[model samples]
Target chain A: MELIKVTIDNKVVEVEKGTTILGAAKKVNVDIPTLCHFKLHDMNIENKPGGCRICVVEVDGRKNLAPACATDCTEGMVIKSHSVRVINARKTVMELILSDHPFECLVCAKSGTCDLQSLAQQLGIRKIHFEGKKSSYRLDTSPSIIREMNKCIMCRRCEMMCNKVQTVGALSAINRGFDSVVSTAFEMNLKNSTCTYCGQCVSVCPTGALTEVDDTARIIRALADPSKTVIVQTAPAVRVALGEEFGMEPGTIVTGKMVAALRRIGFDQVFDTDFAADLTIMEEGSELLNRLGKHLAGDKTVKLPMLTSCCPAWVNFFEKQFPDMLDIPSTAKSPQQMFGAIAKTYLADKMGIKREDLVVVSVMPCLAKKYEAQRDEFKTNGNPDVDFSISTRELAHLIKQTIRDFDSLPDEDFDRPMGESTGAGVIFGTTGGVIEAAVRSAYELHTHKKLPRLNFEELRGLEGIREATIDFDGLPIKIGIAHGLGNARKLLEDIRAGRSHFHAIEIMSCPGGCIGGGGQPLHHGHSSIIKARQAAIYKEDAGKAIRKSHENPDIIKLYDEFLGTPLGEKSHHLLHTEYFNRKK
Target chain B: MATTEIVLKEKQVQQIKDICKQFNNESGELINVLHKTQSLFGYLPSEVQVVIAQELNMSLAKVFGVVTFYSYFTMTPRGEHPIDVCMGTACYVRGAEKVLEEFKRQLKIEVGETTLDGKFSINSLRCVGACGLAPVVIVGDKTYGAVTSADVKNILKEYENK
Candidate 1:
């Protein structure tokens, strides 16, 4: 890498050749405000279209201002990032954007967190002089996402995230110039498109154009209903990231605070989705062992390299993209759905609550869980097992609306039976977690021996795709892990071509798994936040007394009392699900 | 814009698949494939775009994006005698809007809509590099030079009885 010296705002800095002016300016602590330029370091995802000229900077000897994000630094290049001329140009560009944008900040879902809103404030844009006919489009509301394109600034961040990162090509910049907007095929409903409802687009959107469907209103109504017994289940990933909404540092573990807040918010019972994650490990692990045993016995009928179905987005991805390989994934329901099923059935019976009267709500780190809760297979007699699901961000809003001084709240424990979970279950929040959890339980169950080591550090990281081989008492179990649908596509194509060598493959639609899930607090294009969340998940896992799922006393008792055994008739009815080929 | 649900014929689907195979089904050749498909089918409807998308192994949204970005590829079915009024700078200066309004008045249909008899449809296009002709009106394969609002009736008369 060749280094070049550049002067930005009278501060000299050295950067590699081909480094953008924005990159060189950052080394000298010079802030160049941007709207369209977004990068997720370590994830290899960037959206630098240079379409929004808000990052324009004055350059020596140049006739016109250059976009700092796209302009490369050269030797002895002099740049003025905050010069009056550059600031005036950036303000004009921002004013033009605001002129076309809707003035609904008072009611907008992204009022405080909107990048566009903050940029306007930062630029001191009190009024727009270039106001004209604002482009308007039909508001599209899907089960998991809402598309309010009226607020779109055409930054193309969502388009880049949808196509370049997730590879779920449900959105594209259609039409031309003035009329261009990111939309599905023929401007159709998102439910009808190839969208997996992964919410990766919503995660990257800088404006209110894309957002998770606000299910918090529905949840509040359910909680206010006295006739209904509302129970809330918090997913593992939510524990590590929920505190960020309350001004805590990223990866701050707020499990106890969250439970206490939920209790204050009027929930009759607060449980842990990690418990069902343990339940999933037992059922999915048995299924994996069963399939592996049959494949080793030369049974060509059994499907090798079973995929983990813990992610609803990954499930939807395969159902739409790889319809033929539906049978390859484990039939176990996701931890969210598993919790709902057990809560409506075993827990409801134990507490003497009627099935119809019991309301099961989940706090998940995914938008797909909102769609997953409403899936037909998870319903009985037009009533869903899970009444509804809310994202970790929604949970934070609810806490803010009900509790005061959340940071100073005393630590509280979860309600019995369905609340106790093992370390294996807690680790399901991060990448490589589901597979690692399955291995811990599957190894002991298959060999009928106590494992020497607990943590399989080989199966963890921030890599998009990872492969690890764990020795199960002489049986080398090959495992493949892929986060982000694009990387999952590579593994799926290899499997489709009969080239995959692994025995099990775990796929999460979002990058960095559930810790970096679309419904969590936005990382604002920071990959370090995801890494911190992943580390916090492992920290929570290591602190638990029982690291293996089978060792969880409540999970053991649930199987002994009500479920009978893993993969048994009762467990299959409650814990398993089938996939559909939604190719069209 | 309202679009009616359309189902392509079995043979029409096969034709699209063949055209995609000719282009090696490369997603990069989407524009070329769409042009060829539109030429064969007269227009790129949603049904035809779906077949092309499947053959190319690309998302329908992507194929639709390409089809919509260019003015040449249309989703609606064109009339037997499609009328295109050049709305370029040169043509606009030479009473192109009046010529377009006259055609729309005679056809009893809007710019993108076809006549009830399916004989004529109107569309406004950019420059056709026929600046010397100024206001040019194209009907089917015939081009009328320096066309006026009065010439609109004559152009419709030529398409009639054919």
Candidate 2:
């Protein structure tokens, strides 16, 4: 390690290779307030990376204070993390930043949770300074996220996380210098990006600049409607995240408490999204085989690397960036969309409920899902199938406001048939989940043999890129899996260049998949986000007895009664869909 | 994809006109019209994008974000000079970043900003399908793999003269 000698407040500190002055200050407990610098990938408390001038420090003999987060510590470098001069510079910078920002944090949705507010309080910034040009961004209500560009600090943590950690590049600095806004390439809404509804961006945001569109008020109205019957479905990721709002561990499985909480919040039925997740595997697996067979027979030229469509963000990404690959997207709609379609169609028929009368509310772990609810694809019989979608964070708040003593609530189970989920369904909360779940069903259906190993260890990891080869029946199927947008680019490029020999690939927009979704409860750019979410997914998966989607008895009955079997003609039309080759 | 002639068709122009009717200020909605036109036609031809300015009462430069900021909306007729530089994390760290900065210095334009000539509209892309070849730059139809700061002036000159 290259040793760098640094002096802070006249105290000498030695730090190692490639370490920044701010990083070195952190070592000596020299607390430097930073507004722009943050570490999006680091899940630890002290690991957040640097960005703004708030963390500026005096470097011995340097002309101006370099941003501590970006400036590297050097040998024989004299640094002052804090001083009267440093404090004034930082305070002035804070005042200047606050000048351009909206002051409605108290009345804003992010009041208690805002990083800017917390930092302002820490710095004791009381006086209003220079008033600059206030941004006027139309509050985009296009399904997934509510982006108030006026509230944006341009710390670039969201863009960095979305572009770097996730590899989605759904967000970026869209303009030059001061006029820049972190936006998708056409100032399009988040739902327009191949944003997987994994609400990871919302989780990392310091302000309400990026937030899951709050549909709690809408859901409440739906539940209170005297003529309407409201049905709720909770994604597996929700169970893992709900506990975070209540001061519980990130990975705590609040499945029973979650069910009880939703019921207490006034839902007529509490169905599990895991049930639909199982159904997705059965349908997607069959769809994959049919496409593969078609490709092998020269019957289809477009049916290769059938990208998983369940990830709304990834779906949006493909449609926007690589529209020609639409033919490659699985015919299967996302589990959320599939659930909404089936809840209105199959479940509505069995319950003798009118499709118009049933208000299907989904408790999701993603914000992009809220956008997916309104996409043109989700509609079959018109009237948006999923009436409202609230994130796990919003659901937790609604539950807290409605259900007092939620922790003391009795363990409850999701209603049967539509509520019953397999181990494969539970795994859907994590990355490599759909691929793993599909493998279990496909291997059995094609080879007439069990998957043998419970852990598909090859496909499970935190890397941006992962590749695995499996021997199923008589074929050696190569598989690739990627979590986060960055990884997706690498994996997709391989396929585009014809260097990728993999038959299938799984891509999620978040780092740790759905458990680390964009709309989950956020961390302060500390490093614990992914680790906490991953622990939650694994815990949920371990707790399940029957893990494979095909093993779910309800799923068996689903095929036995309505769909016939996996890959059947009916499954393709009702459950699956396609994509378009977007223009450059 | 809709051609320039098709975009100018009564139905398409009428649709853009209809969209302008919804917004309170038609000038504010010019970019949206440009976006619609780009959606209709794959790229934003100067003539068509100018139609947006004429219809919405905004300047041609005012629709820059709608024309260039979005990956979906293209300007300068696309195929003429598809100069793209990789700006992804790995590429940025590997120094395609410096090359991109130098492109602005050399070509007198920024990432999304096109040249005055319009024959060489430079764009910095997010990892232009070439990561293994670190610090990658693509000009027109050719990939000028593994570029550096020193390569920027030569690269621009190569495109300019060509």
Candidate 3:
């Protein structure tokens, strides 16, 4: 590759050809503040519209200041990134952005985290000079997301994430000039559009325009009620990422501290979603084996390449985009729903509490879990099995509001019965984890023999799409895995065209699975944080004594004492769900 | 802007599909397809955009975005007779605003709206490159040059019979 030399702020640097001025400046340790420019370096996702002029820099011999993000660095070009002329222009642009923005930072959901707010602070903008009519619009609230378009800056990062990364195409830049805003067709509510509620758009938005619906208040109300028995369940991914909100390093395991904190917050009992993840393995694995047996017996009606139905957003995607193939995914309900069903039935009955009085709260690393909890199929009569589902970020906020010293809290253990889980359940937080967990138990059940190895390293990675073949006593089982919804679309197209050869497929709607979920602590366009969390999940899995779901004693005892068996009549009604056509 | 609900007939839906097929259903030809579809239906409503989106295999939001970005596209139906008043710089200096106000007062409807009888709809446009005819007003295909506020009543009388 060719090289070019440029001088930024009196510091000379050499960079590769076609490098942006911002890139060249970074090499010389020159900082140029920016907005509407986002990138996940390891994930190959970037949104560089350069519509914001906050990064404008003075170029020698050029009449106009150039935006550092979009301007290419030329050889022998002299640039001043922070000269008087450039600083004045950047401050003026900041004032213009704030002039039309609402001054509700004290109560805004994204006050401290908002990029626009931070840029104004960095530029020392105390007051606005140009005052005019501030654009206003109706606030839209859906089951999982809230859209406040009045605070939109038209950065288009959310638009890029929706259309380019996830391929859900639920939002676009509508109208022109001052009237333009990202919205669905006819400015319809998100619930009426093709939005899967994956929350990827919420993750990339620089302002409070997009956010997950806050459920912390409702959860606190349930906890305060004397008649309600509120129990909390934390997903495996939340443990690895929740520490970031408390000034801890990324991927710090806070399982024990989180449980202690929940107990301190007045929960009647604290459970783990990992236990339900093990139950999912039992149900999903049996379903897989049942289909494989029928397909091998020359049952032409059987559908091969069964899809995993653990991710709510993925389920919504196929239901909306590929409604004809709804029968192909496993009918087992997600781990969150399965836990809720059991909590409302078996757990409530065992503890002598009424079903309606028992409130099941889930702390998830997902935004879609909020929507999944409200699904009609998971409800009995008019009462939903899961009363409230809050994101990992909301949980952190609740902890800060209730507990004084979270870091100093002593280590604690989860309650008996539903808190026990195996290593396979803990791994369900990352990509390829659900299928790998299924294979661990499915292999032993199918062959009636002990497997030599436990770890299937080939199935795990950060790739968009992956394929692996595991030998179940010489019967090769081809498996496919896709993390992002865009990659899942490609795999679905292959299946529709009769080009698929795999026996099963696993799909996650988020980029790096639940660890990079939209409801997790904001990574600020950094994929390395997601990678760190992925490693932490595997580390927790390896540290456990029993690595297989079938070896969990509590799971076996529950099956023997309360439930009859996997895929039994009781299991079908409580642990399984049906899909609907949502294309219209 | 509030839009009344519009349900297209089966035949109208087929016509939109045929227009998309004429462009080979390519997403790049969305502008051309929209132009042809609008010519057939007089305006692009939400229902018709839904059909075009399905035929082109693109998101409805994307199609709507393109439609709203261009000023020529309209989501409301036009009347039998459309009246356009030039508001270009040349016409604005020649008392065009007064002429437009007279039409609004007489028609009892604002710009971009049709009369209750479906007779006439008013709109403002940029330069038609006819500066020589300052304050120009066009009703259908006939152009009126140097038109005044008093002439607005006569223009409505000519269209009342048609």
Q: Which stretches of candidate 1 lie over 4 Å from their true place?
A: none
The C-alpha stretches of model 3 lying farther than 4 A from their native spots are B86-102, B129-137, B144-154
Can you rank all candidates by lDDT, best first? 3, 1, 2
Tell me the TM-score of each prediction against the true structure: 0.98, 0.76, 0.97
What lDDT tens digits, residue by residue, belong to model 3 across residues A62-94? 999999999999999999999999999999998
lDDT of each: 0.92, 0.75, 0.92
- Candidate 1 per-residue lDDT, tens place, A1-584, comes to 89999998888899999999998988889999999999999789999999999999999999999999999998999998888998889889998999889899999989888999999999999889896889989899989999999999889998898899888999989999889999999999999988998999999899999999888888889999999999999999999999999899998999999999999999999999999999999999999999999999999999989999999999999999899999999999999999999999999899998889999999999999989999999999988999889999888888878888999998999999999999999999998999999999999999999999988899999889999999999999999999999999999999999999999999998999999898999999989999999999999999999999999999999998999999999999999999999988
Which segments of candidate 2 are over 4 A away from where they belong? A9-13, A28-30, A42-51, A129-137, A161-180, A183-201, A292-302, A581-584, B1-162
Model 2 chain A worst lDDT window (10 residues): A42-51
lDDT of 3 at A186: 87
- Among all candidates shown, the one with the greatest DockQ: 1
In candidate 2, what are the lDDT values of residues A6-102, reduced to their tens digit? 8877778889979887778878888877766666454321323454578888887889887888888878888777777888888888888888788
| lDDT by residue (tens digit), candidate 2, B2-39 | 22332367776666566566664377666566666665
Error of 3 at A498 (Å): 0.7
What tier of docking accuracy does candidate 1 attain? medium
Q: TM-score of candidate 2 restricted to chain B?
A: 0.57
